[model samples]
Target: MRRVLKITLVSVAGAALALNTAACGGKKSSSGDSGGGDGKKSIKVGLAFDIGGRGDQSFNDSAAAGLDKVKKDLNVTTEEISAKPDEPDADKESRLRLLAGKGYKAIIGVGFAYTNAVVKVAKDFPDTKFLVVDADQCTVSGSNVEGACFSEEQGSYLVGAAAALKSKTGTIGFIGGVNTPLIQKFEAGYVAGAKAAKPGIKVLPAKYLTQPPNFDGFKNPALGNEAAKGQLDAGADVIYHAAGGAGIGVIKTVGGAGKWAIGVDSDQYNQPAVSSVKDHILTSMVKRVDTSVFDFVKAVADGSFQAGVKKYDLSNDGVSYATTGGFVDDVKAKLDQYKADIVSGKIKVPTKPGA
Candidate 1:
């Protein structure tokens, strides 16, 4: 038998109230107490989502799936909170504090933006374990903190190859949510993979929706739409976006134009928000955030938690390309061969653009 967990969607204001309620003893959990009849300890887990949160149908949703799996497979109680667009670091700190103060034994922060906040808060709540996705624990060390990161470039490479193989115009495009090193990795791999598949491929200059400190790029569909239109008008027949929620606009615009659009993080073809344009989705560069999150929580529950970074890559099935619409079926063999070359060290994907 399993317990059902109710996850609430609360605004930043509502989160403050939830924090206040927790301070007044709303819910409580003891450290590693075996409560369930099955001898498994029932723990309280808190998830701090990235911008666009659970319904973005992309990155945050992938993390939410892991939390959902934790709820189904383990004896645990859960709470989730999301970040606002362009929110300050203080807000992230506060969210982590809120979860720690609520007595959550394990807290997971869903994006790289939480790096500083996770480092700061984990210090105050040494008893509570913290995991920040897309962050490197080695760089931001904390005794109680761990990181879940992925080789996004490796996955992006596969989709870029797919786009190159399918493109009839010999031109493709890459759109990033923010102009950051992380997003650049996606561009680098896409370009490298496209060029690898076809030596004469023409890739347009990368476009970014926003720069640092204005992360709204991740949640702004309008920006994505504008960028996609520009690329399409410039003769790009296939477009790939690493733009989180904003990718919805990319899909819509590309689909409306009957061109191919590749997705990131989650399989957009099956994403309900983009169901109407599923046919236009070429494939997605699937990064397994869900597996990493579940593994982190499970480690804490089993008292095997380690404070360090864990990297998920092609060899571990942590990153790969999706084939949801069967759009890439004809090119699957070539893509797999590329994947094998990458895994076998015969090919090394670039992590920076123009590298």
Candidate 2:
């Protein structure tokens, strides 16, 4: 519930008024314009999603949940656009610019991949607020772009501890979508947590599905499966992935191996798409993207939208480890103690791998 200020203004006549507005040139509200027929304020928010958008049952879907919640609770109009594989940076700028040009009050770029696009597009439209979910690249010293960054390493550490405590083989594996600092945070935190739980725990060599300038790693389930199988064959009994949609393949592979798999971004165990193999998912590193998105919308609506970095961490409910299958119940006490240490500054999880 970080910065979540919900203002309830029921749009009883919203449909007809929206129709009339469209009929009358569709001029978007600028600087808090309250031009509705019933004297209520109206605002438009837009979201640009990364690969595996909307129904991947992971990252994109979490952001979609936020958008849906804001539309329902605040009665604001919304728009969403998904990304194409290997789309150029210019294409990202174009998509973001389209939303800005259409008069969206707040436009959010859903992944770190949109850092460049958000940086370039926000400068031209000073009046509109922009948010980048994963990367803080756009929120430089004087930029008017806000960043909704998460302490992923902190959450990853918790799940890593679970994997360590649950490992019967004394070895676990982590699969990342890309070989970038962001994904590396997952590896770093997971490894740190595992070591913290078991001083001699052996983490198999971490693997990435792809490298930079090629983000299909986040979407390609086949590659995830390939990477995971390699780790599992190496005697790793518990596997964790920060590979976005690709993590689905990691989970499936773990299921087939009759081992444990940790999910990311959402409570993946409850996801309908993964129901068939849900039992294999031991836990998920809940990223709270929905909470962040909803908070951003509320900020815009309240006219308190600031351009800077806002971090969601263990202390703020921004990140945590989920226990959907009760597989981690035996280790819950240990994990809780570790979480308490993190929150109380007694433990500082590394953000960069090998740090």
List clash counts for every candidate, in order: 0, 0
Tens-place lDDT per residue, model 1, 1-355, is 1212223443312221223232223432222223547867688889988988778889988997787777767767777877766777887897789888978989998899899999999999999999999994225588899988889999999999999999999999999999988899999999999999998999999999999888978999999999999999999999999999999999999989999999999988999878888999999999999999999999998999999888899999999999887999999999999999999999999998988
Q: Per-residue lDDT tens digits of candidate 2, residues 141-231? A: 2256888888899999999999998999999999999898888888999999999999888999899999887888898889999998999
What stretches of model 2 exceed 4 Å from their correct place? 1-39, 137-143
Tell me how candidate 1 scores on lDDT.
0.86
TM-scores for all candidates: the values are: 0.90, 0.88
Assess each prediction's global lDDT (C-alpha) against the native: 0.86, 0.82
lDDT of 1 at 27: 33
Position 61, candidate 2: lDDT: 81
RMSD (CA, Å), candidate 2 to true, equals: 7.1
Task: Provide the clash count, candidate 2.
Answer: 0
